[model samples]
Target: MKPDIHPVSRPVVFRDRAAGVAFLTRSTAHSTRTIEWEDGAVHPLVDVEISSASHPFHTGTSRVLDTAGRVERFERRYGRTAPNRR
Candidate 1:
């Protein structure tokens, strides 16, 4: 380990604006904004537009693409042809 070479790591609050969720975690990221946490302590506030709470994948709201249907449509538009297996 080297002295005076490592970046400072501290607690930071990442707030999901859309989901209105905030969590405190240790990060090297710095922010000028601050917010009062649940523990009555103010930490660096980082505002984010998306997080696991509001993301479509995490929320199970993501749309599944119909690849099979798309292939059928393509075949209907243009007749299927054998692929070069060589």
Candidate 2:
């Protein structure tokens, strides 16, 4: 409830280059680039490498890591050791 302390929030356009999608929202982040939104208004354009549109988890394209294979590889590289008995 403080006054003159919060950063200004303005309409900004976040463009996801990989997914080729643009979203209009309010944010404190600033950018030198500008984009004309569908509403015929210019908004600061921020380019992001990845967003929900293209992220593996969000897109359901995430790969399950091969932990078993990794363990085997590590053991091969450094011979497996016997359990340390206290």
Q: What is the C-alpha lDDT of each candidate?
A: 0.95, 0.97
TM-score of each: 0.84, 0.81
- Model 2, 1-86: lDDT tens digits are 99999999999999999999999999999899999999899999999999999999999999999999999999999999999999
Any runs in candidate 2 off by more than 4 Å, and if so which?
69-79
Per-residue alpha-carbon lDDT of model 1 for 1-86, expressed as tens digits? 98999999999999999999987999999899999988999899999999999999999999999999999999999989999898
Model 1 residue runs over 4 Å out of place are: 81-86
Tell me which residue pairs clash in candidate 1. none
Worst 10 residues of 2 by lDDT: 30-39
Best by lDDT: 2
